[model samples]
Target: MPPQSEVEPYAAIRRDARSGMSGRALERKYNVGRRTVVKAIASAWPQPRKKPPPRPSKLDPFKPVIDEILRKDLDAPRKQRNTVKRIFARLIDEHSMSDVS
Candidate 1:
């Protein structure tokens, strides 16, 4: 579902417009641009935000190594299993992961 923050303004703008509020007035009252006022008047719902494409991470190459460590940890004693600090230490000491912070 779309968030209430995005939906509420659209509903308010449309409602105000139907009650004879001017586009410029709606923009001022709602603190939005002329284009936003136009879109709100045209439709009851706002468009969903665009999702950014996934980018490569510094640890992308080391993911398989981390996964293998985690998989092995499933069989180890709970107290001896890898914590985040241990994982980071292992990445540095064993895998020579110097670039990632």
Candidate 2:
């Protein structure tokens, strides 16, 4: 059989407990923690996981320079246009972007 979702177990735990199942029994039955059993009894749905705040990237400072290079390339012929390799080289040599790979 397919694995149950995060929700199905919580609903099952609540229903089983209502029929006079102990907290320890619920934990053993569901293969979940004591806190998980308590949480299930408290609420129908599980609390959403918290997300970490976004961090700045090394390329943040050089984004405008890259954009300008791309914009200028729009006027150039396809063969003469700035490639990724060329861009990286320009950043390192011209802009001194040695820190970023």
Scored by lDDT, the top model is: 2
Q: Per-prediction count of colliding residue pairs? A: 0, 0
lDDT per residue as tens, model 1, 1-101: 85568889999999999999999999999899999999998888898899999999999999999999999999999998999999999999998898788
Compared with the true structure, what per-residue lDDT tens digits does model 2 show for residues 20-61? 999999999989999999999999999999999999999998
User: Candidate 1 local accuracy as lDDT?
Assistant: 0.92
- Lowest summed lDDT across 10 adjacent residues in model 2 is found at 92-101
State the C-alpha lDDT per candidate: 0.92, 0.94
In model 2, what is the error at residue 9, expressed in angstroms? 0.9
Off-target runs (Cα >4 Å) in candidate 2 are 1-3
What clash count does candidate 1 reach? Answer: 0
- Full-model lDDT, candidate 2: 0.94
